[model samples]
Target chain A: MADKIFRVNMADLTTSIEDIPADWAGHGGRGLTSTIVSAEVEPTCHPLGQNNKLVFAPGLLSGTAAANSGRLSIGAKSPLTGTIKESNSGGTAAQLFAKAGCKALIVEGLPKADNWYSLALTPDGVTITEEKELIGQGNFAVVQALENRIEGKHGLLSIGQAGEMRLASANISIKDPDGSLRSCGRGGLGAVMGAKKIKFITVDPKDGKVAIAKPDAFKDANRIFAKALVDHPVSQALGQYGTNVLTNIINESGGFPTQNFTKGQFEGHESISGETMHDTIKERGGKVKHGCHQGCVIQCSQIYNDADGKKLTAGFEYESIWAMGADCCVDNLDHIAEADRIMDDIGIDTIETSVAMGVAMEAGVLPFGDGAGICKLLTEDITKGTGIGRIIGNGAGSVGRAFGITRVPVVKNQAIPAYDPRAIKGIGITYATSTQGADHTMGYTIATNILNVGGKVDPLTKEGQVELSRNLQIATAAIDSTGMCLFIAFAALDDEKCLPALVDLLNARFDLSLTGDDVVSLGQHILKTERAFNTAAGFTSADDRLPEFFYNEPLPPHNVVFDFSGEEIDTFWDF
Target chain B: MKISVKLFAYFRDNRFKIKEYDIDEGTTVGNIVDDLNIDREEVGVLMINSRHTNFDVHPVEKDILAIFPVIGGG
Candidate 1:
């Protein structure tokens, strides 16, 4: 069967399989999701209203033997940012959707009644059934219950209480290969899904295979690509320490946001560093390196354990640690891990929620460094949808509005992640100008600014930072479309063979003669298309900026502020 | 000159995390790395007094030097 689009209408509980549209044929993952959302969703519609549509797309190379090509893209008009948003995650869903011959899954129209539903996808088509048992459950419970309800191995996407409450920080959780959860943890897409009345969706691809136009060539390209990935030093470090490796390095660079962005470095950084996490994991009988999806050569994820030697969180990442640790001034790794587990179960974006905690702490909701208090709020308030919980769950911008806190570090309503933009000027441009809001993944200038993977840009300076952000954002758009993990970028920037081998894999899979320049064009086109959608949605260049605090306050240690003028930031769109 | 040196990630393997070194005047950052038996190629980031620096530069007294292996993640 040729790849087809699966449409599910909650209004009437109808399902249909349609031919892949010609215009969307060349796009996949973020490209396809953004294109579909741009074309189908009304820009001015309330994100949780009937007019908003949610899209799920596998990357062009997904479901194949290509390494690190299992990321799934989920797009919608964001309830948090009110911009066109695409958040991708690592899981089996993308590969399963591709294997089931599904190019994309579009869910639209809210049900008139309050009944929730679940959609099951197969090679034939989608089947929508009224869902009741898992409606109010957290993601872990839902995944656990479905294991007995479903017959065989299946790919799952579900939301938790936060989603059910329609909080802006709600995230759609994807089931990993090991039954742990990976998340489309940005832009409040989970709330959109919850608003559409979907508790969960299951995908089962039985004896299905993705077709490769040139099998031999594809094999050769994948070998080269995977080799380049595993051979890179950054990849090696990630495997050993997981993404938490950045705690010490970023803290050392004096770009680590601490105590709600008031300081550039954390005093207790050593206690929460990746090295400490790694040692703790080893001592607690946990795996230091684990892959979130199949065929991922750069396994940056890990299984974190508590002092009792039991699993606390899987796929423990740096952003989550930094958000709950340095940002909120909590240094206990176990507390952060427990909070991470709760956020995963609650189906909330950790970055958004923890950053919200930071803002709430600034508001005296709880004192800073209160790890247990943060967890208590996550369980008692946010999960139960209390008034205070809603404020924090709605995200950093919402908390700032609710409490009149001025130092809320957000761009376009989305919480800024681990990197402090004040000390790192290139990332500041990315935070200001990103179409989907303040997402580090939209363009990780850290590679150049801090890590020196691509090259040095002197992160503290304004020179060449705008052009650096523009080029990276363009390249990131293309990469996000390919279903490859963004970690491939470290190798892509430094290794000469990496990007070419990736292009070769795409060419071999699609039987096309695409050059590197064509990849660049695809990236540029995706960015422009998404930008046009945001523009139609009433976003102007004025929206492309950081919070005033970033410009006004000088972070300590370095004592540098994000000094880029509005005109300098506006130049990011000159490309 | 008393220079405080901090090592992170794998650079701390079989070595101390932080130590104060009273070194001869005009000693470069590379001398500290070589004295500590850390490979130059394995160093991802090198900084002194919270400023990114190269190995060739000489360190002043009371300078805090931080060394890390190549590490990248979002």
Candidate 2:
């Protein structure tokens, strides 16, 4: 078995070699990262300090042409949320890492100085090179520099000035096939990389092709999985409209956080919804349905263009649209597209940055719907480190604090994602209780068959949300470890056969026997571990809650307030 | 009888861009959706006169209808 571990210590510039435990071979990717992070990192320590380690791993099915399986996860204690965080991204890195014959790469400790550097990995070993010249460069430029140095095709993960400044909203940008930037953009993990003084990582495929443990079984399983993804209605919608498909649904549900959550529905939501984006791209002849990673059957990304048909940004997904469009009250798609480009280039978490801008607007820094002004602030002042831009880059909670805004929507310092908890009660429960604050992916409720694990209740009822959230969190934890994209859960929920097929694939790949029940157990274990860590870190049950405004001011359209009491919310994890 | 209908997301691009439809009086949101040649399964939630409505809810003149997709987590 080709099992190896690569460890880099920034404090002393030391590299060590280790062997992976035999049990870990089956885990791979996200599973490995979660395990390692939980075992090694101290939960309550300063996230940017030497106590936290950043772990990168590819999925169990990655590197073998498993459609949509080329995902890499970065796990760390979040500087922004003060909780466990794992952000997954699609690019060439995971495939390259798998090909290099290493299951995981762990970067531990912190550099002693403010110097900038990049890590270059080859078949031989890892090399740290001075990249001071590339300091302060945006994500696009940083990727270009690394690409030129590596020769031919190379996978990269780099940060922009926002990370360099240790901004909580920073993101780690991964180079896409077209030289555009995609990111593992949440939980402020980029700041952790920045704290390590590492500017970028270049993974060259010169390491060779990845070898699958069971090629025949992998191929069979992947074929079935790929077909399922292609046939699913959710996949079809995503392929057609990209992520902006949620705009109308969220608005209709009265959960599209508008004007800084002062309102729920955006009046001009249709103009910026996924359908509008698709039409605009078609009329301009721009490319739609771009893939984030190789061999992805459901290409739910897009290359948005301006009126002149010039490319503005790639993969302007739903979270970015809600944060910039509905949250900020901007209806114009072009403006939202431009803002997306700015966030990508600047290496900022689009969700956090957009929410920060909304909060800033609420503070009267700029009027809501001032899309042009927001763009200028991000592109010009933020890069230049101006006064307002500095606070905006700091993230939503910080910006809210700096401006004395009380209505900021956040939990544990992390700005909430696109979903409004009041309308989608189950999702709100997830957001409130997730180890990572206000994160949607921690327990996605929208498009999953959650087994009715929590007794069935009306979608509009608050009765079973806490239980549903708990079940989803456990299931999500298990899925994350396999390095499978959480999107797969959509099929897994609806297709009773899908989970068993996935288990079979895992068993064949690792040459071990496992069942669907084992997957559930594994997921539960991960959630329990994360919860223990958070508890040890001093987070109490009270910390898991929505903002008071959610309780007092009912959201529009539905007019449903966040009604779950703290005691009821705490009952979620009783199982 | 005329009803103001706004198609959001993919529905707008696919079938509702060119012109607004005026259906017979007492027509339901379901009927208008059927008349527009839009697949009912693809539409997730239906709103009539700014209130949440089931697919079976009938429509009236001057009533505004909004339809959206079911799959929405990002």
Candidate 3:
């Protein structure tokens, strides 16, 4: 069966499988979600209201035997950033959705009844059922309970207490192969799901398979693609240390965003460094390397354990460590791990919530370096939905507004991640011009600016920053569409065999003659479509800017402020 | 001349995390990497006093030099 658009109306409790629209036939993942939202969703609709539709899509190569193609893109009007949002994650859901012949799943309209529901999708269609037992539970409990409640192997996506409270920092948690959670961890799409009163959505392919137009050609391309990914030195490093390897590298670059973006380096960076984390994990008998999805060649995820060797968290990423560790001045790895586990269970974006905590700390709600205090706040406040918890749960911008702090680090109301853009000017442009707000993954200029992967661009200079960000943002949009892991870009940029093999994978799967230029065109089209939606939604160039502090308070060590004039930043859109 | 050296990731596997080194005044970053038995290609980033530098650059006294393997992640 050709993949179909699955639509569920919460207001009327109706489900329908519609034929794939002609315009959407070639699109997948972020491209499809953005295209669908632009076509169907009203630009001015309240993000958490009935008019905002939530769309889930697997990439074009997803569910195929392609390496690193198991990413699922979830899109909606963000209650957090208030821009058209697409946050993707790794889990079984993408592969399952693709195998089930679901090109995209669209959930729209508000539920009139004041009750929670769940959607169960099979190869046949979707069924809506009333959910009662696990309504207010955290994501961990929900997954455990569903494991017994549902029979057979299935994929789940759920939201927890934060989502139930409709917090702006809430994220949709997707179940990994081991039943642990991986989050679509930005832009508060979970609040959209919660507003529609969905507790979880499960996908069971039931032996269904994604059809390929040229199987032999696809197998050959996938072989070359996987080799390119595996042969890269960066991939080897990521497999060894996970993404946390960047902690020390970024810290050394003096762009680690320490202590609420006030400084660039942390005095206690050694304790929470990836090197320390790796040795600690080895000592505690935790798995040093793990994959979130089945086809992942680069297993950047890991199972971190507490002192007693009990599992504390998995998929402990650099951004989360930076937010909770350096950005908050918490030195202890175990404390950061505990808080990480809590955030995962709560189904909240760790970057948003922890950065919010940093702002709250600056407001004197708690002293800095209080890791236990951070855990206490998450448990007793955020999870319980206390008034102060709501302030933090709404994200860094909300916390800043509540405390009257002028040095808050947010762009378009979304908290900036680990990088301090004042030192690395390329990323600063990306943070400013990104349609999804201050997201590192949207462009990831760090690869070239700091790591020298694609090529060297002077990090401290403003000369080539705008052009670099524009090119990266465009490529990233296209990469996100294929559902390939963003890490593939390291090899794609440097390895001669990488990108062509990727394009070959797409061509072989769909039987289309897409050249490299076609891929670039796809990327540009996706960005323009997303930008057009944000434009229609009342965003001006002024919205595409970093906070004033980035330009005023020069970061330490470098003693440099983000000096890009608005005109320089506006040039990012020239492409 | 006295300088501090900070090594991270696999560079610290058989070596110290941060150590103080006393060297000749004109010692470049390459000289230190050679002394530490670290391959030039293996060095992903070299920072002197928290700023990006290369193997050819001479570090001043009291500089804090950090070395990392060819690692990249977001």
Candidate 4:
């Protein structure tokens, strides 16, 4: 297969092709997107403005038959967090993209008219076609329409009404192999696409393959990587119970982030626990341990169905459950599932919406634990983009601002995920300082603090957690760039061969001579690039700091406050 | 001595989610896991009085010992 670049100038609605530049040859997925944005885009430009460009690239091994290598990265200036952002997902689009011999797709400039368009990538080139029919449709309806229009097997990436209205927390939804959708869910990249007036991008490759430099070496490495994933207990657990398994564990640990961060434990946790969900799925004849994309041996995703055996949602992840359930005090899993479906259809970040729901409830907009109320809010209010709906769609930070509430648990204006910072103090440090706002995958010190996979870092010990978080963040940045699922970290931390196997895979694919040290350097370079961009965009250490409320209000279980001083948080930038 | 024990994730399988038992105050957290037939290797995090500790850590009066299997997500 051949490899080239597809650049779309949205200003004039023109498309062009260029050779894959030598400098960008080593990078892919998050790496390439960050590099390109740093080099080409203005850091200080308004995220919804013409100067901001949205870039999409497949992972390093995406097009190939590498296990768990189908995650696609979309990067741009975040309207939600005002930071350089890279959001990822697993879907059919990445594989088709890689197979088409396309290295990266960059959409730049802005359309003069307020018209929507869609791009189709075929064997020869990309075509920018204007579309009026698909403008206001939900993601599911849009995908069905696209499939009907194309009349063949293809991959899709489309946004919903939230994106069309340019909400700050809108996400880009990617079509999975099963015609279900997975999302690049964070940082409002969908709004960036909306600003460009692109409705969706379709990839229907006639025939193409990944350009492999050493197929034999890649195959050998693949065998090792695949085995490592299959042989891991964590992977097995994820396959069986899925990520929602954390409900009981985190609740038992007394760090569940209940009722909008007011408490750490949920009394109704058992109702929405993974074990309960697993039993319900089995009774309802839903498929469990399903892969969202090809070559995923772990299969942590699942298809959740209603009592009538009708599909409700796929890949009902832990963060979504936690945000929609415990954080909002909604114990009804079915209601949460419906909320998930609506969020998927509307193209909004679930974590942000969950936090916004909590804020809305706290502001007397709706009572907490009102499942029906939440469903109505999501369907009738948020989906239609009403006045108050606009605030919720914008994200937790905006909801808090609208209601004048101070307890919003957000960093860089992005809502924090499941874990409670006060319970795990290291997470507080991470939430306060991560380059991408309150993101756990950025560093995920939980591997050591909770799982004890890498090494023991006492969760309550400030010094150790800081050092542990720093090292993990560096390693994580590198892993995210490779298009590998972050779950590989469990195997990588335990089995010494895991990281080497991944490096070997990359080296074989690209014919590059890279060492373990190079990976570390690459991670550092990427973080530094992002940090520099945020700095130039007028972000200060003050923006990096968590709100003052976390310091004053001690969370239960540990009853520990977020005591990390400004100095400790600033140390995260030392690299 | 009265002490409380909480198990998390897969450890809850065939085990109570939270149970209280009367035992010697000097009992090690390792003894409790072993007594419950939980493999030391299977136990990921050990918290004594809500602080991180190892298997060798001995409990004091009213100490809440929480045992978590390798529960990893997000």
Which regions of candidate 4 fall more than 4 Å away from where they truly are? B1-4, B20-26, B59-64
Q: After superposition, how far is residue A294 of candidate 1 from its true place, in Å?
A: 0.6
List the candidates ranked by DockQ, beginning with the highest: 1, 3, 4, 2
lDDT tens string, model 3, A32-82?
A: 999999998898889999899999999999999999999999999999988
Q: For model 1, what is the error of residue A439's alpha carbon versus the real structure, in angstroms, after optimal superposition?
A: 0.7
Query: Which stretch of 10 consecutive residues in model 4 chain A shows the poorest summed lDDT?
Result: A456-465
lDDT of 1 by residue, A454-489 (tens): 999998999999998999999999999999999999
TM-scores for chain B, listed for all candidates: 0.96, 0.78, 0.96, 0.92
Per-residue lDDT of A349 in model 4:
92
Which of candidates 3 and 4 reaches a greater lDDT? 3
Deviation from native of the Cα of residue A104 in model 3, angstroms: 0.1
Sorted into a CAPRI-style docking class, model 3 comes out as high
Least well predicted 10-residue stretch by lDDT in candidate 3 chain A: A268-277
Q: 1 or 4: which has the higher lDDT?
A: 1
Best by DockQ: 1
Per model, the share of native interface contacts recovered reads 0.89, 0.39, 0.86, 0.47
Report the C-alpha displacement of residue A182, candidate 3, in angstroms: 0.4
